[model samples]
Target: MSMPRSIGSGPAPRHGSIARSSFSASYLSQSPIAQESIARDLAEYSDDEIEQPESDSEESGSEDESDASTVRPNAPQHSMASSYRRPSFVAFGGTRPAITPHGAEGTFLTKKEKKQARDEERSLLRDNHLAPPKHPEPSRRNTLSRIYKKVFSTKTPKTESDLEDPPEALFSAEPSESSTLLSNGPPESKRSRREREDREWEAAVASGKIKTTWQREAKTLMTNASPLVITFVLQYSLTVASIFTVGHLGTLELGAVSLASMTANISGYAIYQGLATSLDTLCAQAYGSGRKHLVGLQFQRMVYFLWALTIPIGIFWLLAEKILELIVPERESARLAGLYLRILLLGAPGYSAFEAGKRFMQAQGLFSSCTYVLLIAAPLNAFMNWLFVWQFKWGFVGAPIAVAITDTLLPILLFLYVRFVDGRQCWNGFTKKAFRNWGPMIRLALPGLLMVEAEFLAFEILTLASSYISTTHLAAQSVLGTVTALTFQIPFPISIAASTRVANLIGATLSGAAKTSAKVAFIVACGVGLFNVALLFFLRSYIPRLFTTDPEVIRLVSTVLPICAAFQLFDALAANCNGLLRGLGYQEFGGWVNLFCYYVVAMPISLGTAFGLGWQLEGLWTGPAIALGLVAAAEGWFLTTANWEKAVEDARERNSNG
Candidate 1:
């Protein structure tokens, strides 16, 4: 073995000039007298003479020598810091030497020992590294960082060498590993290893080894979607509470209430909800373009148009008893349903106003507000229903009355919040500008209304067809419909989210991003639909027991529930694709698609199979499932082939005109 340079004796190597493993502390500590003699002799040399290390041929020869030799003129003195450890050197042209930071002593440490040392050092330096402490104790920022590290930290320990240089310096000053590997002559002529690390990082992102944009979008969507989904679910639960309360009254009461609620949903609520959705396209684009006032104007117009339609709709509800009697010979049930309809009509204007408010709030990205309000109102609705029906003894009349009170309160509360609390900038107190030329607004509103109502009316026709089988069949069908409605709530938010997001992107003229949003929405909706299908299939036999205990009703529900489960994927696809079309100003296309699929295709097949062919209830649902499948296919094709650039142009024009 060659003798190492005597410590504090001969002239030393400069900082980072020599390899870490080149010297031994134990060997130098052996002869203090000899080190002193060499140190006194080396004091004559200048820093420049001892700055650069010799090549490996010279270094290897020095290691082999048994006796001390004359120090090279180019060797630099190591006077930087006694405690500092230099970074490990890269093997530019040959195999890397073993790293030993404390001369030869550093090689003795196991991986665990090295890790423990690093951790201890990190803890000691943590509070002093960033901003200086204000007091003797750790600052809140430092304390929070410690807590965060404890919660989210990985097991790996980082060495001081890794933290010594800033990333920008390392990346900019060095060359890639590939260049060094390929160089057959002098490796130092090419780039350094640090640059290679930067290149690898960029490549990793490009290859998806480390996700960037898509991951960011996924997290953004999840954060925005969770509350919206919860809001839809909680709102739907109010309907469930009403059904549960009224279903216990008796079979006739249950059937009557179910028929009444379904009629209101199909005829009144469905049509109005559809009409109000035109605001989703207009308001979302408006908000995206920073035209906040336009969102309020669109909302006002929707309220105006919807409230006007309700007057004509209220006349239809007045004749609902006769309409019900014509469809089914159950005169007693029809009379009861008409009575329920008349009471519910009191809340129609409130419902219209609330729908408009929700779209307005949703457009401006105030997603959590809707959920917060619904959370309070949903429970209140349930309590009020219990109070009026059971405590006040108003019978079936109480359910609609309770619903009307809450329905009216919902819009009032939303308006108060928007007008005074958070949405003041958008509202501007409802303008008369909303009452201008109604031609364009009417044209946009009609298509969306027709699209949703066509599908809803088709299902109602199936319910009417169920009446042809028997009233018991109708009652059983109602139970099945409730279960399906509950499952439908799962994907409904994805639809709303898709439309709002796409419209915003379109308004911003981000066609690529808008297309990506559509694709992601479809994927998320489909996944949620499939998950619900699995859950429904798992609980199909048992869920009917929650609604009714009658063997016939339970048996009928158990039979049809699986079909409902099968229909969910297609239903989700159809709904989300319709939302995409609405965002693209293609609601008219969706309306025509719905008209053909539901009325022309689904209705005929449903009626013929149930009544003409005598296939009963099973045949009734087969039509809708098949029709939804066709609708999904058609809409998916349209969305995939859509010209997103044109969508942006159309959105701008619509918002400007509105």
Candidate 2:
């Protein structure tokens, strides 16, 4: 005759929710293991120090002390003769074991009694007649110190010296008998989302440079300069072929080729470079962190993923004439530009894929592949241009066909090389994990894409704006633009190398090295820009002859060459700033910088100066010069002022849980 457990005042249903049944059975044994353990621990404590068990439970959850005290538990000894009754700590009737409880004064609180005491304490606090207690609030300084000790105490590896001793040793390769992964996670995956976050946070906490430098800034500048040199060579080659072949066909064919080449390279530069370079950032970081598998997976996914993005680009290629008609108002120029753009576009996706694959290799410190790939394709592109235009008598259309074939071929060749050569050689480094996760790809690409679009739009608008000027002015603008494009490659490669190094040093938490690298890159770019300025001034006459020999066009172009010469310093600053920002995952900031430079300040002032100030075409180009120069100086100084240690500390704080 034990009293049954109560379920409210109503009769209980035979069948109910599964949870209700479990609850009914669980209430029978209220002395859970946690409660028992607490009781056992309290056995060693003095009677006055032992806390009430119910109060401990309530405090754990923090909101139910009153409810806990209302429990009408059936006593263990009084069970033989019991009746359902209102709860009272002191019993009135029944069992002899309940007659005299002698040791009760020892003060070991039962769960129910402790809960009652807690409820009384709270009630007293709420009582209107009782005065409020005066207590000082917890200071953040003390709390933070405790937290710091907890995080960075004996277990925290603070210095290179601290890491010498191993902490709570982990199995070298997991337990052999029942081996858990000796690796971090899935065999294909090198680093989990959580793992990367944790390590980055830890590195940041150490106040280490995520990007560092020393003598390498000069190297970074040299690296950036190579492409500029190459660009100049390519422009020379293009001009030689166009004049040699299409020059005999009259101004229409010559102009057509001009429109086509301009459209093709401009599109290729942005679309292909944007996607491919973003991959380089990812691959570089992965390489730095020793995530061998991610490099390959990233490469593979990019190949397939690029195919998707290429569809729209491909469509533009296919419909180049239609697009030209819409964008270009002069009917003849529009038709000619459209025809050339369409042919060039046929080879868009292939060229784009080539760019992406090459960037992956570049990130691995394999820039030679780019040179090798260029060796096979660039000369072939030139030869094909001559053959199709002069050798086959296809005219302007032949140049586009030639570009298309070569553009597609380069990517195919690179993809094959990566698959057969790098594929088997570095299986571990080419993990399939990156292909599986879309997160990294998206994070890297979005910002770069924004930059590419903004930059491309700015130039396209310039072209449109230039069209508003006289024909001679338009020609000068184009000549200056083309020269700048060709020569700017000098600093680009250095920027590329700096980007990879910054990412690597940043990841390693080598703050000093990262700073050195940025400075080195800046100094190198400045030197290269200075040399380029002097060289352009000395060879001003020969430079215009490279594109065309039309006396008037050449004269206007020569006049503007000096203006182009003046912007190299600005180019160095802006390009390297872009590198620094991209390396430090400040892509969004770069985008904002571009927005301000291109639209907010530069475009309006330059446009106003060109048209409003009666400066005309030369004045329009001057707009971006001033804007880019100012932005470069500001961004470079900002990079200088940044607290690398604090940045790392913030990153580490975010990643502690992992």
Candidate 3:
């Protein structure tokens, strides 16, 4: 499968990124009155002690009378129950006058006399109402219900009085004081509200008020994964439109379009995508650091950088026909494929801009911007392909023209969204500062480029290698690759959801809950894999007909498809395992593992088996299958034995440093 687009899903729980709040600690330290109240309350009651009754019962009337008799008769009578005792002032570093024997003014008090003095003092204090009322502790069920209602409820508070205390206050070390302090704050900003919600969520999880059960995790994963499925599938359809429209022309057109796409992806689009990924970190960090203008700066730097890189990319596409002829055995196919690339070059800059712009919107937490853009662009792209390629009688070359128009349209729509709707604050107009920051961007961009290129190259290699075998094999490889990639759209999104969920849990320091989420993800992956396996296996004979009418190509695809079907489970498992690693903040490890498996293990096995063993197209797939299996096994074992607590610690360290 091609590298999945890292589309932001909008304020989804992020691991290690939640702002750590010191509000409670700061409040206690700054407010001496609050601290004194808390200390006095703690000193007054043991954990096991029940609250004193508000009034004396008939059964305790005799005891109350005896206690009252011990008090000085000349002293004023108070209305408070006689059973209650005032807390000793010494507990919080204060002094109270000692009580003497009732009739002896100068004599020291006995223990019984001291008790009576304390009760009398409590009565006086209650009459003056100095102590706060003690509220009953909420049951677990009530706490969970309240938290869920606050988080998921649709109702907005109509007035200031309707606004409730922040949930984090409920579980604070000193709930009463915490509530008072939190409620007294000024209206929160958007950032502060988000941070408050995050803290509240973490507090709930930590206190076991929100149970991260497998059922809930699965439901959550599906809820998050659904929209992404639509977004990715729509974005991918942009390229697929070209192939689908051109494939119906002839076997030569089919093979040529496939070869052109492969070349364009490897040489141009992948470079744009990979390099653009650096903005994922840069723009987000800039926006997060409260330098809103820096978001625009980073975005400007990336767009300029990508545009600069396009100079060489344009040159490469211009000369690609000659270069392709040197590599591809079929001269006609090579010439046509190169022609496709040359024409596709018109869209190159626009495509790159869109890649950068998508990240630009994502940084501001507008993930749906591109998806909305695609909702229009994708359909328009398909219509243009049909209109230009077949209806306009422009033939094979018309496919690239339609693609170029669609590609150019993408950034325009995204730009409009930012300008009129939202995400406008980040852009403070272009400045020279964007041009000055090359080193950090390039340093970050290279790793992203490598990570993206590694996977794209591994998959595209099969198409390139197929050209050496036969034109028929090349056409079949195209169909196989497309089908596999389409099926991948489902689980890939699930993996993303899984990653976000696991990361959020880990960030909350709920390692055990994170593990439960991981398990649910794995189970979901297996289910998706089985469904795909059944779909592909059952549709193998008919599937190729969608791409080409060539009999040999169709036959070859049908024959080799079972092999692809057999590996679906591995593909799903491997994808989710990588996601789990990303959640654990071990994405670098995943990148290295993918490189090693795809290049070191899968490539040799594929080349050797396809040619040396004469397994042909089936052998080409065998390497990826085995590599995916190994990847799944290796990563799965690591996760099973992994130190989740350490992962949480690592997340904390990253958050602190970032």
Of candidate 1, the 10-residue stretch with the lowest lDDT total is: 1-10
C-alpha lDDT of candidate 3 relative to the true structure: 0.61
Which has the better TM-score: candidate 1, or candidate 2? 1
TM-scores of all candidate predictions against the true structure: 0.60, 0.57, 0.72
Candidate 1: residue 246 Cα off by (Å): 1.5
Q: In candidate 2, what are the lDDT values of residues 1-658, reduced to their tens digit?
A: 0000011110010000000000000012121222332233334346764333233232344222222222222121111001111110110000001000000001012233334333322222222112122232246558788886555432212345323522112112122334344465444222232232233333332432122124334444454445534532442343344444553444345444544544553454444444444453454333323333444555666766777777776676667777766765556766876777777667767755665565456444344454555556656767887789878879777866876787678777766676766533223343334345554465555544544444445554565566566444544555565556545545544554565455434433445656777777777778878887887777778776765556766786677777777877777667667656655545346556656776787678868987899777677778777877877877777787877765444323322211
Off by over 4 Å in 3: 1-210
| Candidates' C-alpha lDDT | 0.55, 0.47, 0.61
Error of 3 at 258 (Å): 1.6
The best candidate in terms of lDDT: 3
How many backbone clashes are present in model 1? 9
Clashes of 3: 0
Provide the clashing-pair count of each candidate structure. Answer: 9, 33, 0
TM-score of 1: 0.60
Judging by TM-score against the true structure, name the best candidate. 3
How much is the lDDT of residue 482 in candidate 1? 65
Rank the models by lDDT, top first. Answer: 3, 1, 2
